[model samples]
Target: MISNEMAQRINTQINREMYSAYFYLGLSAQAETMNLKGVAAWFLAKHGEELAHALKMYRYLIDQDARVQLSEVAAPASVDGGVLPMFERTLEHERGVTATINEMVDFALSAKDHATNIFLQWFVTEQIEEEATVKDIIGRVRLFGDQGQSLLMIDNELAALAKQIGQGAATAA
Candidate 1:
């Protein structure tokens, strides 16, 4: 069973995850306006992933018989500049998420909540993958230059990746 404090913290994380989904949705809309369909699709896929993360936490809280207090999710600011900037923002957001997850892990450990700690290990690993993936994408954008045929090629690759991610999410679901 989770302590009230831990449950509250997890509830906070659920809200943050919900906000991340909104953030990605906003980015996807921005990508669509820029005519980067593949980028938009990628962002949409990420939005789905964020929702899944929230649901996972929700289920965990239920399993632990803790109250899941959900608060309002703030709207994300409009993303602009360009695709690279958008991804930079994504990386920044993801890093923030990683920090929060780390904090939760530390909290769980210090509280001797081994079950919660074990539960959070999944998020710890997920954050590592998320940050690395964003970094790699940023590197690719930098290496390819974000324009013309090169951008199209990159966009195409993103589209393929989105499809793969979508399939994985579907399978997981």
Candidate 2:
């Protein structure tokens, strides 16, 4: 059984993950409004991934015989600018998530929760990839800067990337 303190921390992480899903969904909406279909699809895929992340934590908590209490998710801000700004926000968000995961890892280590630590290893590695992916997208978008054809190519690239990441996650599971 997980300790109450650990369980509470995990629950908070779960809530944050859910909020991430909402945030990405909002970004998807903004992309759609901007007529960036590929970017919209990418954010929609990210929204699904974030939901899966939250569910993973929720299920893990239940499996460990802990209570999973969900809190209300805050509203996500709409991105009014271009793709670069959207991706910049995404990178910032991922960095924040990495920090949160690191905190959880620290807690698990301090408490000698070996199982939680093991489970969190995946997230640590995932954050590395997440940060890299956003940075790559930002770089690509910058390279394309206001070029419709280049943006299309980037969109296609992102679509493939989304599929690849989704497949990798599923295969790992």
Candidate 3:
């Protein structure tokens, strides 16, 4: 069985994952309001991914014979500054998550919880990909600088990405 302290830490991370979903959902809403359908679709995919992350942790805790104590999630921040700012904020948020996960890995290693450490390696790799993806989007958005046709092109690309993500989930199901 996992120690109570470790379990509590994981539960806290789960709450953070929920907050991520909430934040991304707010981003999606803003994208939709701006008529950036593709951006909205992308954030919707992100929101789903965040929820899945939380559920993955939830299952892991249950398998470890730990009670899953959920904390309340805070409200999402406003995303009123348009796409670039939204993505910049997302990249910043992801960096924070990466740091937290690293701490968890360190704690697991010190506590000799090899199972948890091994499991968290997946998240470590995941964080790398997450940061890279967000950074790439930020770069692309900055290049466009709210230009009409260029921004539309990026939106189209994101729409395709959203579609691909949808199809992948459908196939997995």
Candidate 4:
């Protein structure tokens, strides 16, 4: 069983994960507005992944026999800043997630909650990969996002990426 404090923190994280989904959804809309179909699809995939992330935590809480209460998710900030800024925002958001996970790890260790700590280790590794992936995307955006033809090429690449993701999912099933 999980402590009330731990339960509350997990609930908060779930809500934040919901917000992350919305953030990516909003970015998808922004990408669509910019006529970047590939980018929009990429963000939509990210949105779905965030939903899965929240669900993972929700299931963990339920498995722990803890109450799962959801709070309101605040609106994501405006995405009017464009695609490059969206990636920048994504990196920043990921950095914050990494910190929160670190805190949870510390808390788990302090409380001797080995199960929670084990569960959270997945997030620790996930965050590192997340941050690195976003950084790579940001670097690519910086390199190609400024040039029209180049940006279009990048968009095409992203479209292929989305297709590959779909294929991978299909094969896994």
* TM-score of each prediction: 0.99, 0.94, 0.95, 0.92
- Clashing residue pairs, backbone N/CA/C < 3 A, model 3: none
Question: Sorted on lDDT, highest at the top, how do the candidates line up?
Answer: 1, 3, 2, 4
Give residue 153's error in model 3 in angstroms.
0.5
lDDT of each: 0.95, 0.87, 0.90, 0.85
Between candidates 2 and 4, the lDDT winner: 2
Task: State the lDDT of candidate 3 residue by residue for 58-165, as single tens digits.
Answer: 999999999999989999978667888898999999999999999999999999989999888988998998899889989988877766898899999989988886
Among these predicted structures, which one has the highest lDDT? Answer: 1
As for candidate 1, its clashing pairs are none
What lDDT tens digits, residue by residue, belong to model 4 across residues 1-173? 68888888889899989999899899888889899999888888778777877998999999999999999999998755667888899999999988988998898888888999999998899888879978988899887773589788878877887777556545633
Superior candidate under TM-score, 2 versus 3: 3
In terms of lDDT, model 3 sits at 0.90
Model 4 misplaced regions, further than 4 Å: 164-173
lDDT of 2: 0.87
Residue 21's lDDT in candidate 1? 98
- Candidate order by TM-score, decreasing, is 1, 3, 2, 4
Model 4 clashing residue pairs (backbone): none
> Which candidate number has the best TM-score?
1
Report the lDDT tens digits of candidate 2 across residue range 12-32.
Answer: 999899999999999988988
